[model samples]
Target: MQQIKIKQYGNAQEAFAFEEQEKPVPIDSQLLIQVEGFGLNYADVMARNGLYKDAPKIPFVPGYEVVGKVIQCGKGTPPDFIGERVVAFTRFGGYAEQAVGDFRAARIIGDRISGGEACALATQYCTAYYMTDYISNLHEGETALIHACAGGVGTALSQLCRRKGVTVIGLCGSEEKVAFLEAMGVDFIINYKKNNYKKLIENRLGKRKIDYIFNTVAGNSFKEDMKLLNYGGKIYCFGGAARSGKKDHILNDLAFLLKTGFVSPLFMMMKSHGVIGVNMLRIADNHTAVIGKCLGELHQLWLQGEIKPVVGATFQASQIGEAHQLLESGKSMGKIYVYW
Candidate 1:
């Protein structure tokens, strides 16, 4: 088996090294997938830079999702799963030619779906589904704000909100993304780089307060979102893209934390505002079944044409460095996939 390993923590080009390794065998309820390709998440970039706390130590493979055929199944797994084409959620090890994942986290895909689309269903769409359907209740006539609204999860969230008849206020960093979201039928698009998103959203909404906010850029944005939230509104914090590009030092980490500021439980209670933090890795660790349910539901939605996965770009496994660089650049509009 061949895999890309993180040799060191720094820029993408200097951090990765290709190497040959023995193929891993699945154990317990796990399945070994002959990986066709894998998807890139922002966490992979954070892992490469040594910013993700839960990432494995140096020399480890960094990937969250894989689309491939099931070649082998472990104990308690069904033999019928063998030879099935599926998308699976890998804890790490997904950067290799083969990877193992809990059978419960794997879902079969039809020939109609491309590998890049299947990869989106694993981590990105599942995360969006878990937040929108599992954790929060979205209703018709409500308004929601989505950060990074042109990326993988953001695209998924936007479509999901649309299905529920909720108006979407999408925030992006570039005009290209604004056009992309506009084509996707986003109710409103704000280029945060060119204008104050807070004022723009306020001007657009007038007296209507946001009912929900899907925030990936944590920092001063959290405080800003709180101000725009309605009494019953809730904000979901999932990523810290704002922390990227900081100096590799403890002081820099602390400074980023300070910028996010602190929240008081008493204040939130009195104001009737709620803050929810989502770390899918932790959820997968303690409640694997929840992830399985989310994946299954998302798969059904895709099959029904209720949601579409956006493939921003594709790269060969040898171009892993390029993939990381593009994802880190935040210029890619949708999911980026690296194929073996």
Candidate 2:
């Protein structure tokens, strides 16, 4: 098997080292996955920087999702799953030509879904769907604020939100991404680079407050969104990209924390707006069943033509560094991946 290891944390080009290794054998309840590809997420970049506490030690494979076929099964694994292509929510070790994962973390996919498309269903779409379809209770004619709206999870949430007839205010950092959101038919698309998005949100909704807010970029993003949430409204934060960028990004996060401290628990209770944080790694580690269930639900949505996974670009496994750099640049408009 060929694997990419995070040799050390620094620049993306210098962070990962590719090497040939013995093909891993699955242990009890694990499946040997012949990976066709693995999804590259912003989280992968943060892990490379030693910023994500959940990440493994240095010199580790830092992928969370792989799209591939189960070529072998270990003890306690179901017998019928030996020959299916699936999307796997691996806790780690996904950046390889072949890898081992617990059977519970993978779900079967139809033959029609491409590897890149299947990759999105496992981590990105599941997080988006779980938040909007299951938790937010978003309704028809409601208003949603989707930050980083051209992102992987953001695109999935936009699709689901549109399907439910919710009006979406999409925020992106680039003109290109704003155009991408415009093509998705967001009610309003604002380029955060040129416009004051907090003020944009205020100007767009003079009186009506946001019914749901999806934030992955934290810091002032969450603070500002909190002020605009409607009574009984919900806010879901998954990542803090504001705190995870390259070059002095950690400094930026510390600055924000120093200035704002934390959102007052008392204020949250008094305002009657619910705030929730999601860490998919925790879900993958403890609630593996939920991981499988989310993938199954997303597969159904794909079958019904209700959702489509967007792959902005695909890279070869050899180009892992470039893939990470692209994700770090925040220039890609949708999910990015590297395949064998």
Candidate 3:
């Protein structure tokens, strides 16, 4: 089997090395898959930069999702699952021609879906579904704000919100993203790079306030979102893209944390505001069943045409460095993946 390994922590070109290794066998409740491709996420960039705390040590594989066919099934897994074409969430080790993952984290898909589309469902769409449908009770006529609203999970979140009849305020860093959101029928689009998003949102809402906020940039935006939140509104923090790119710098990390500031539960209780943080990796660790459920629901949604996963770009296996560079640049509009 051939796989891409993180040889060191630094830039994408210097960090990865290709190597041959023995094909891994599935253990209890696991499935061995012949991977077609794997998707890239912002966390992969963080991992390459040695910034993600949960990432495996050096020389480890660093992918989270893959679209593949199950070639073998392990003990406690259903035998019928063999030969199924599925999209699966891998803890790691997905950047290879073959991989193994827990059967609970895999869901069957049809032949019509492309590898990029299937890869989108495994991690990005599942994360969106888990946050919108499983955890929150979103209602019709409500308003929600999505930060980084042109990316994979952001696109999924916008579509899910639209299905619920909620108005979406999509925030992005570029005009191209604003146009993309417009085509997707986002209720409002803000280019934070050119305009002050806080002011724009306030001017548009007038007396009303945001009902829910899906915030991924968590530095100063945390305090800003709190101010714009309506009574009883909740803010979901998922990523910290606002953090400086100085890896392993204690002062820089502290600066980012300080900018996020402090939150008092007492104040939130009095104001009826709520703050919730989401780390999908943590959820996968503690609640494995939830991953399966979310994957199943997202698959159904895609089949019904209720949601669409955009494939920003697809790269060859040899172009792994280019894929990482695009993801790190944050200029890619949707899901980016590399085919084996």
lDDT of 1 by residue, 25-77 (tens): 99999999999999999999999998898998998998898999999999999
Give lDDT tens digits, candidate 3, residues 177-288. Answer: 8899999999999998899888998898864399999998899998888989989999999988887377768888899999998899999998898899999999888887
* Pairs in clash, predicted candidate 1: none
- Which of candidates 1 and 2 reaches a greater lDDT? 1
The estimated TM-scores of all candidates read: 0.98, 0.95, 0.98
lDDT of 2 by residue, 110-133 (tens): 589988889898889989988987
lDDT of 2: 0.85
lDDT of 3: 0.90
Against the reference, the lDDT scores of all candidates come to 0.91, 0.85, 0.90
TM for candidate 2 is 0.95
Q: Which stretches of candidate 3 lie over 4 Å from their true place?
A: none
Residue pairs of candidate 3 with colliding backbone atoms: none
